[model samples]
Target: MKICAIRAFTPLTAALGLTLLLLSFGPASSSTGWLLAQDEAPMRGDKKVLTIDDYAKWRSVGQTSISPDGRWVTYAYSRREVDDSLFIKEIDGGDPAVVVRGSNPEFSKDSRWVAYYINPPEQEDGGGRGMREAGTMPTDLHA
Candidate 1:
């Protein structure tokens, strides 16, 4: 499995982790085809970012990213329900914990800030009218 980012460059589709348009990278001595799917991260000093085996560990729909210091990983778990609810798990030395839930989860560049989408569910009224649910911030986790 080659490490490549999704190269469609389009919003493409909204199918859980399939929505990701990642940048793929290749090693030296490779000069055949154009880089597809995703682009490679530009880094120096002979440090490899991630390997194919690591990426295979998690399911595709959920997005995963290595921490800046490479200590922990923050990713979304997208198969909680039939509707594909999201969950953020902080994997460290021990068990991972649920950090948040929703769609399109992301972390800020500094890794201090984070963002996600909140598709509020519609509420039904006794009168048969329905309304979309409002977005709310997480109340039960550290930020």
Candidate 2:
């Protein structure tokens, strides 16, 4: 009896196969009916189509840090068309302290304080044509 060896497709192969499959449809202008149909079809289960207006609500997080005592955490959240904010929260339970237009948080050695950069307000002149600079440090570190 002879046995055949089976081979599994890697991600690259799968992507290439999909690309070839799509390319087989010929020019997009002439063969995009099926793709357009999928977009135009009514979604089931109360699903709604996404629009450009929803992009402003999207947010991203970066530069996370935890205090040495493991009781606190700091992170930065940024949104499109809006200012970024830094948040310092107690791990166990407490309301978080929010710093508007802040990023890159760091905990002090004793875990009693935090340091972060404060971004300058956005400039409206020519929609910010010039290059923006880094955030400035706070002169007063007191709470």
Candidate 3:
């Protein structure tokens, strides 16, 4: 049990350590998680596969919208921009072409209609004249 007797590691041990270190750093996926690894490691064992609904985009930066059937999802690919307002990706195929570009997008309750706004929010504002010709503001000061 002499602490001083523990000499340096052998070359074989050093090689084994290096190999393991490289392997762990290369690619690995947890058995239960939404993240995917770069490698094709069958680490899931007997666990079931997952879909887009199981994960959420950046909580603060982006928003998530799930379809009624939970088979599809739409989220902001990047910042809500004029060219790419929102993107709709299937849980299975989930191709990029399924994206909807415009101001505000709307999905039907039954996951039927997927409409993208044609105009901006500012333009859509109902800021027209009132029903009757109203006068100045309520000038009756706090009584």
Q: Residue-wise lDDT of candidate 3 within 1-143, one digit each (tens)?
A: 11122146865445433432332231223222222323332337665444443333211113344445544444443322223345454544423333333323445566655545432233235563223221111111121
Model 1 has an lDDT value of 0.38
What is residue 61's positional error in candidate 2, in angstroms?
Answer: 2.5
Q: Could you tell me the lDDT of residue 114 within candidate 3? A: 50
TM value for model 3? 0.33
- Name the runs in model 3 displaced over 4 angstroms: 1-61, 79-83, 98-101, 118-143
What are the per-residue Cα lDDT tens digits for candidate 1 across 24-83?
112321222222212243446774354553333222345554333333344554322223
Residue 103 lDDT (model 1): 58
| Candidate 2 lDDT tens digits, 1-143 | 12222256765445433433343343222223222112333357776464665545444455565566656666665667778877676655555677887776766666777777677777877455344344433312334
Clashes of 3: 1
Give the candidate number with the greatest TM-score.
2
Listed per candidate, the RMSD to the true structure in angstroms reads 15.7, 17.2, 24.3
Ranking by lDDT: 2, 1, 3
Runs in model 1 lying further than 4 Å from the true structure:
1-61, 94-101, 122-143
Worst 10 residues of 2 by lDDT: 29-38
> Can you tell me which runs of candidate 2 are displaced by over 4 Å?
1-47, 127-143
The window of 10 residues in a row where model 1 has the poorest summed lDDT is 23-32
**Cα TM-score per model:** 0.35, 0.56, 0.33
Q: After superposition, how far is residue 141 of candidate 2 from its true place, in Å?
A: 13
